[model samples]
Target: MTVVQIRPARSADADAIAALILPIQQQEFGIPITREAQPDLADVQGFYQQGSGNFWVAEAGGAVVGSIGLRDIGGRQAALRKMFVAPAWRGAHHGVAQGLLDTLLQWAAAQAVAEVYLGTTAQFLAAHRFYEKNGFAMVDRAALPPAFPVMAVDSRFYRLRLG
Candidate 1:
């Protein structure tokens, strides 16, 4: 298994991060979002910088293989976004996703965020299980925070409370 390093994303890592996520968003999950449509992939640092949030990237052999983001929605709450892992580095073996999440959560705790929320599509069954396993609780759409920035393709939502 390849060793992975999870760290805060830099401005230069935008393209590699976008390349890593587009395939999964298109072929795997069949999301309609395109690279041109999702401008955030081109500016990771700018997109996730709201309130007290930040973005993270997982790299293996200097290549970005996974990512996760925390978007602060004010009122001590934040929204989790762009959590993805490449197929070659998935499962417990690579630990890419977990590392990214652990890093984000560690930062979130330090930032004093009370809750972290996310919106995902119904087709992501594995993602749902993964989120649940990591302490995110499923909630109805109406329960989502007003500032959560709901995406057009999002059909499910989850929230996790931090200490």
Candidate 2:
């Protein structure tokens, strides 16, 4: 088994995370992402500054292979966001995603959050299965925020009750 390390994302990890996610996003969306859709080091760094979210990266053999983030949603809940694993690193190491989810769950628990939610595209069937395996259940589309357009078309919402 490959040894994987999970750590809070640093500003230096922004570019690497963006590179890891852009292709996946592009392929899933079937459209070229604009600069606005692509996350940069500055954006991840900013999230650290705001105190409203946490970002983490997974490393194996000293190389970043995956990342995930959690953003606080007012009232004891958090929204899981930006989860991606390099195509080269998928499969049996499913533990990597589990590790990320575990970390986020711990953080949310610390904040007294009772539940966590995530929005993902239908194109990512593997992710849907992963979320379900991790105790998330599909929720009504109307339960999500209005700004989340991805939910209107290809998106599905999953909720994990922490309590």
Candidate 3:
């Protein structure tokens, strides 16, 4: 089994992060998104690692296999974004996704985040199940906080309240 390390992402991880997410978004899911659409991946420090927000990467064999980011939107709320796990590292056997999420939640709690909201495409059925199983509840678009960043392809939303 490969030992996966979950750690805070640095500016240097931009390329690796982009490499891990774009294919999952465009090819596997058929979302048709471009690298230009995800400008945050280009500036992890300025976009995600500022204020009370942060980004994390799961590394195995010195390569990023999974990523998750929290964007502090003020009012103690945050938008969870860019969560993706490479196909080879997914599932309970690898636990890349779970580890990334655990790290994000721990960091959010430490930063006093009151809620974490996420927007995903309706086509990502497995993702919807994973989020639901992890204490996130499905929410109508109208229920999303005004500050929550909704992506152009996002059609389903979920919210997880934290202390």
The 10-residue segment with the lowest total lDDT in model 1: 42-51
Cα lDDT tens digits, model 2, 1-163, are 6788999998888778877777777775574665465443458766532444688999988888889887766666677878888777787645788788788888878777777778877778899998898899999878765433242334689888887
In angstroms, how far off is 41's CA in candidate 3?
1.0
**TM, every model:** 0.96, 0.85, 0.98
Which runs of model 3 end up more than 4 angstroms from their true locations? none
Indicate the residue-level lDDT of 2 in model 3.
77
Model 2: worst 10 consecutive residues (lDDT sum): 145-154
* RMSD value for candidate 3: 0.7
Computed on alpha carbons, the lDDT of every model, listed in order, comes to 0.90, 0.75, 0.93
Residue 80 in model 2: lDDT: 82
Model 3 alpha-carbon miss at residue 11, Å: 1.2
Models sorted by TM-score, best on top: 3, 1, 2
| Global lDDT of model 1 | 0.90
Candidate 3 local lDDT, residue 17? 94
Q: lDDT tens digits, residues 19-70, model 1?
A: 9999999998888789998888887777896668999999889899999999
